[model samples]
Target: MKLLLTSGGVTNPTIRAALTDLLGKPIEECHALCVPTAQWGHPMCGPASVRGLLAAEPSFRHLTGLGWASLGALELTALPSIGRERWEPWVRGADVLLVDGGDATYLGHWLRKSGLADLFPSLPDTVWVGVSAGSMVMTPRIGDLFVEWAGAPDDRTLGVVEFSIFPHLDAFPTNTLEAAERWAADIGGPAYAIDEQTAIRVVDGHAEVVSEGRWFQLTR
Candidate 1:
């Protein structure tokens, strides 16, 4: 499996370069399916959220401006809502699955309810790019220690990755290195703390860190 789990979406040159490298192609030729299910977990999943996402164009413009293609938003909240027949092909055809972040529990619930988790293993060639909660849901669990930040507290996750990730370190309110360290100390297995400019890239079970900011890992 190939996964780029990030604290924030692509926002800096290092990350952009890492993504381009992961794809083994110029950013211009990539086709991404933006999964925004996480936004729904928040209180602003309506027009305001849409506008906010659109406003982030400047940050992701490296790809958008480079002739990269996108297929609107993929709402994975439910099977019928996303039209499995149509969206499934779109997801399979895309080179990258770009997932936004919000409540990890909510996103994981919908992903499983929609049967998307079952499909992940089939998309071996597709790069799974996750931002924050999007990244958290792929782990075995989202620790309760982070309840103050994640809003929801469901420990069950996709388990796509064996470890847990603590994102937005020092970026969001109440998020700090000390808090991340404490959370990791209590975790039963491996855990990592990633800042906005950092990402954890895992390929074929091997993990590597790509960052322009702070990040640390703890292992049991």
Candidate 2:
């Protein structure tokens, strides 16, 4: 699967261009699916947040409101109950998966439990557009500093990519570059600290940063 991992959604032209490149088509023509599963794992999110996303509220215009040809919801928590045979088609039919942010560990847990993680290997042409925790979930670890879910055993996630991510850099007072440096030291491996206007794009196995804002790569 191709990856367009962002701290925020497609909030800028550069990132949107990267997403379109990954999709190989216009956003209007693509059939998209929104995964709100990660939001449930966060204390600050709930029904209202999920509803706003699905309804394409102004706040989510960069994401689900991108005006796709069609849009659908895929709740990972419900997948195990229905069986993969019934849901596989739904995933296979979509052009891209818009994964919103919350807790990477929680999203990773369900991705495994729901068997979606196992399915990713076969979807070579599918595009995965991830935001914040959605982006972090693709990395090896999120670092303890970013952990917010009470149920998470640790900061580790799927490791779909070889690096870690410190998102929302400078957007939050606590997400300053100095804090990201400390987070990177804790990660002890390749990682990135990206601002809201930045993103990391991965096609095949190669990764590239596409940004209109500040970003740093840590190799400690």
Candidate 3:
């Protein structure tokens, strides 16, 4: 599977160009399945990020927005109002899954509870894309950032790729990088600390730095 793991939204024009180039076409040409809570505003029932990319890209034909599962603490609780049948088809037929940034702990919980963790692996052609919180979930464990009650009872993930991903390294004011380094030191596995505007492209289980940012693979 091809994974286009980004740090956050493609808000920067250069980053957006990089994303388009990596995908081998304009954003409009591909299907954008956004997982929105990857941002801070919508912690509970927010829309996915894929749609935002599509909306920003000039080439994309369809922009599919999947709302979050209600288990989160955010305010957008409209999924139940819209019903499941309306959302299932888009999710099932999606060619790409773009997980937006948000609270990783909460994102992980809702992913499992909503059966997305199980359903994602079954999608044969879907490419997994992540940014921020979306990127963190790709790891085996999550960093301590949320309220104590927000964490998942267990670490269950999509296992799309190996390696713990730490985003927003530059955003953290107090020793965020040091904290990530500590986590990597404790995990004793390949861990990446990516800055905003940076991304890692993993193809067939191999990862390479695709953007202009620092990517460190920690080793003891």
Candidate 4:
């Protein structure tokens, strides 16, 4: 699968262009499946937040509102009961997955529980567009600093990607570059700190930063 891991959604022309290339077509021609499961695990998220994503509210214009040919919700939490036969086709039919932000560990848990993780190997042509925790879920460890879900056993995730991510860099009072460095030290691994206008594109295990804002490699 192609990955466009971002702190924010596709916020700039460059990031959007990268997304288009990954889709191998115009955004208007692509079909998208949005996953809002992570929001359920976050203290700050609630019904209103989930509604915004589903409805493509103005604030979510960068993600769900990106004007795909069609958009549908694929709530990972519900997949276990529905059976893979029903949901698997839904996933494979979409051109991209627009995964929203919330709690990474929680998202990771449902991805496995919903049997979606098992499908990764079969989805070589799928484009994964992940935002914040959605992006962090691909890494090995998000560090305790980013773990907000009380149910998570530890600061760990799927580790689909080799490196970790420090998202929302400088967007919040607590997400300064110095804080990211400290977080990197706490985790002690290869990691990146990316601002709202930045993203990390990964394809076939190779990664490169696409940024119109600040970003840094925090560990050697």
Candidate 5:
């Protein structure tokens, strides 16, 4: 599996280029499916905000300019009427799975409940691009880093990757790099703290940090 986990979406040439490289094709030829389930997981955030966020999303504009075909949030898990067979093709056929950030616990629940977790390993050609909570959903768990960012920690994640990610480091109202580092210190396994300018790239089973911004990893 190929994963480009970012605090923010594709916001720079370095990260953009990394995504294009991972796609192994021109951006124009790619078909991307955006999943905004995480944002909806928040109690205060509504669908209007989610729509507004996606409508003017920098990453959406960035990719569209680069020639990508954006499928916008499918909302399959959100809508109960849609069966797996109906949306499974869309998930399986997409060139990229663009996961938007919001509440990690909320998103994690849907991923597991909706059976998306089982689909990750089968998506050999799909590049999973996670933004903030989207990135965190792939790990073993999301601990206390977010604090008041959202609901409680589900801890149980998709497990597509091993390390937990703390995104938006040093950003307002969220985690600062120092606090994140301290949180990582308590984590028993590998974890990372990254800002909007940073990303964690994972190919197969190996992971590496790619950044134009500041980042660090905590290891046992």
Candidate 6:
């Protein structure tokens, strides 16, 4: 599996360049599926989450013309309200899935409820690209942010990746390198603390740092 995990969003020129270089073409060459969390509501409703992905690509002019190429926005909110036959084709047609940052609990809840959690992994040819909260869901455990927001004692996650990924480390209070070390010690495997502009690309079972910031591989 080809993974393009970014720290924040694709709007940053450096981030976009790295992504384009990794994908071997301009940002417009790949089919982008923008999953925004603002539709879910406040706190998670930050525009920066998906602004980068949408701005970097030019193919997403309208919802109907998305299938042509470049980019598309898979409005998760529309899925539950619309008929499956009408929107399912777009979901299946995407070549790259880009998830925006948001509340991990809400993001996971909506993704599973929309029947996309299972569908995404099952797609044989699609590349998964996640930013911030989008990347957090791929792990086996959610971070303290989930606890602060949802207030469930334990973490709820999708378990797509063996370890948990901590994004926006420089901005979040609970995501320090020391905190990541503690989390790794308690959770087993490794915990990745990714700073702004940093990314960890996991292809198959291996992971390597691919951006300009710090990447801490913490373990017990």
* TM-score of each model, paired residue for residue: 0.87, 0.98, 0.68, 0.99, 0.88, 0.75
Q: Any residue pairs clashing in model 2, and if so which? A: none
Least well predicted 10-residue stretch by lDDT in candidate 5 = 57-66
* Alpha-carbon local distance difference test for all models: 0.75, 0.94, 0.57, 0.95, 0.76, 0.64
Query: What are the clashing pairs of model 6?
Result: 11-52
Clashes of 1: 0
- Per-prediction backbone clash count: 0, 0, 16, 0, 1, 1
Q: Write the residue-wise lDDT of candidate 3 on 110-216 in tens digits.
A: 66655566665556555666766677677666544432234456544455667877676777685277877886676666778877767777766777766566656
- RMSD (Å) of each candidate, 1 decimal: 2.8, 0.8, 6.7, 0.6, 2.5, 5.0
Candidate 4: 10-residue stretch with minimal lDDT: 211-220
Q: In model 6, which regions exceed 4 Å deviation? A: 10-18, 21-25, 38-69, 148-154, 172-174, 185-188
Q: Over the stretch 126-207, how does candidate 5's per-residue lDDT look in tens digits?
A: 8988888888888887775453344555455667788888788877665777777777776667888888888888998889
Taking all chains together, the TM-score of candidate 1 against the true structure is 0.87
Determine the backbone clash count of candidate 4: 0
Instruction: Give candidate 5 regions above 4 Å deviation.
Output: 57-67, 147-153
Q: Considering only N, C-alpha and C atoms within 3 Å, which residue pairs clash in candidate 4? A: none
Candidate 3 regions exceeding 4 Å error are 11-18, 21-24, 37-86, 145-151, 154-156
Please give the distance, in angstroms, between residue 210's alpha carbon in candidate 4 and its true position after superposition.
Answer: 0.4
Q: Model 3 clash tally?
A: 16
In model 6, how large is the Cα lDDT of residue 42? 34
Question: Cα RMSD (Å) between model 2 and the true structure?
Answer: 0.8
Across 141-218, the per-residue lDDT of candidate 6 in tens digits comes to 865544444433366677777777777676777778777777666666657777876776766767767766677766
lDDT of 5 at 209: 86
Better of 2 and 6 by TM-score: 2
Cα displacement (angstroms), candidate 2, residue 74, comes to 0.3
Candidate 2 Cα outliers beyond 4 Å, as residue runs: none
After best superposition, candidate 6 residue 100: deviation in angstroms? 0.5
